[model samples]
Target: MLSETPRTRHRRIKENGRTDPADLHAVLAAGQVAHLGVVVDGHPMVVPTVYGHDHERIFLHGSVASRSLAGRGEVCVTVTVFDGLVLARSVFEHGVNYRSAMIYGVPRAVTDPGDLLYGLRLLTEHAAPGQWDYARRPSKKELAATRLLALPLAEASVKISDGFPDDGDGPDAALGLWAGRLPAVAAWGTPEPDPRLAAGIEPPPHIAGRAGAALHPRRPPPG
Candidate 1:
């Protein structure tokens, strides 16, 4: 799992070098939105948008005229999810346990007709599994107006912080402050169908299946 240098290690975090690709991919898959950072006019700009991945490449889309997607050079993409808040006894040690991925690479515009359609499918399905098949396919005019970019997972990094904080054997512990992790999780609510739909319309299996599932702080499916 080691590619360049491990970033999850305590020393690497201290050195500010992240190098775990699996951690990076996991964070990316867990998140539907990403902050795309790129240089504009020699200044840094981060744009928030939706993203999708196929385990080997990450896909992003925007309007054909979007500045973030229309530039002539490389772009940096990052996806982050905060699993919980780590409230340590010491204020200095308080932090968040999170999963994040950073990708640095040049994005190639999707041109081939087949690849473009595939990328769009990936983007839609990433937002919600089984959604693409359930929804109407994009029309020719719609497809022509959209822009898609794909970045290979060749150069990426993941950093994750988990478990309780380092707060024992400190003066703050003696202060008798209540300190521990305040767990945060994302869960989906019951589906509310559109009022304009046909009277007999019922929740589709794909949409209805998400009930009681975690939206953030995602967990692996049961065996």
Candidate 2:
């Protein structure tokens, strides 16, 4: 179960709030990019970055000089997967179907050589499953120029909206109008080889196999 702190308490739309830890993990795994919110120079800044997560924590990295990766005080990381658009007879009843999670905590900078290398591998593998093994690993000079941070997944807020318009049972139902959902799905496209590649070179099976695969697989509802 996910701990419900003051920051995670849902004041409105309580029904949409999810307390299960699995739900949080699912949302994080399905997303590719996360927005990291932090205070820089006393001003709020939100930076988009790729992230990787284990069962207990998430890893984020960027250039060493990046202000957002300073690993300072409190921070908020959010990941969202847009599912679809819900259309209703009335404008007020229109909504969206999506899965989103917000995590708040203090992140620590990864400094140890072994831990930094491990974290970097995780981040790369998360973004591209087999690419990490296929591509050359980062060198000492490259590693020195990168900054990595890890944040605990202890406190988080998860919200999933997948229902149809509630106006279906209300007066809006009687209106002579078509109302439904326009679903959105993301899929991987064919791989394009680099122009500098040799003529005989081609994408590996692991990369080519995902050409038509869904970016985020649909999960079943809880029992």
Highest lDDT, which number?
A: 2
Q: After superposition, how far is residue 64 of candidate 2 from its true place, in Å?
A: 0.3
- Please report, as a residue range, the 10-residue window in candidate 2 with the lowest summed lDDT: 214-223
| Local distance difference test, each candidate | 0.78, 0.90
In candidate 1, position 203 carries an lDDT of 85
Q: What TM-score goes with each of the models? A: 0.88, 0.96
Number of the predicted model whose TM-score against the real structure is largest: 2
Candidate 1 all-Cα RMSD:
3.2
Across 1-223, the per-residue lDDT of candidate 1 in tens digits comes to: 6355342244555433445555665677688698999888888899998877876788899999888887468777888887889888877898888877777778898888899888988888777789889989988898889999898777777777777867777677788888889877888889998889889888889889988888864543111
Tell me the deviation in Å of residue 36 in model 2. 0.3
* lDDT tens digits by residue: candidate 2, 140-213: 99999999999999999999999888788889899988999998989999999999999998899889998988
Which residue segments of model 2 deviate by more than 4 Å? Answer: 219-223
Scored against the true structure, residue 168 in model 2 reaches a CA lDDT of 85
